[model samples]
Target: MSLRTSFAAHRRTRARLREERAFERLLARAPTVESAHELRALATRR
Candidate 1:
């Protein structure tokens, strides 16, 4: 595969993992407005 394709695949995988981890963390935390906002911000930064 070309370098571009490899990079794209890597990015997609990393993003998926990050999303899953973030969801798990969010769930572990209480369902508060502050936690929700923090999750949103963390996702946006990624």
Candidate 2:
């Protein structure tokens, strides 16, 4: 692959990891059923 393509792939991977971490944090902090459901929907969308 070209350098540009490789860089783009790496960026996407990093973004995915960030999203997973954010989701985990949200689950940890979610104290209500509504918030947990919202977080689950958001994660499923991605």
Candidate 3:
């Protein structure tokens, strides 16, 4: 594989990890049942 392709894959993996962390934080700090349900729906979309 090319260097450029590997770089692109790494970037995508980083972005996905960032998004997962953000979602985890959201779940941990979620205030209400309704909001938690909403977050579940959001996560399910992916």
Candidate 4:
């Protein structure tokens, strides 16, 4: 692949990883079953 495409792919991977970590943090701190379900729904929506 071209260097530019490789860089773009890397950026996309980084963004996804960051999002997953943030989601995990939110899941860990979820206050109730309802909120957890909401989080899951939002994640699925993405």
lDDT of 2 by residue, 1-46 (tens): 9999999999999998998898889898999989999989877887
List, residue by residue over 1-46, the lDDT tens digit for candidate 4: 9999999999999999999999999988999989998999988987
Each candidate's number of clashing pairs is 0, 0, 0, 0
Candidate 3 stretches greater than 4 Å from native: none
The candidate that achieves the highest TM-score relative to the unseen native structure = 4
- Which candidate's lDDT is highest? 4
In model 1, the runs with Cα more than 4 Å from the true position are 31-46
Each model's C-alpha lDDT? 0.84, 0.91, 0.93, 0.94
Candidate 3: tens digits of C-alpha lDDT, residues 1-46: 9999999999999999999899889988999989999998988998
Point out the worst 10-residue segment of candidate 2 by lDDT: 37-46
Model 1 Cα lDDT, one tens digit per residue, 1-46: 9999999999999999997897878757857878878877776798
**How much is the lDDT of residue 29 in candidate 4?**
92
lDDT of 1: 0.84
Instruction: Give the Å error, residue 3, model 3.
Output: 0.6
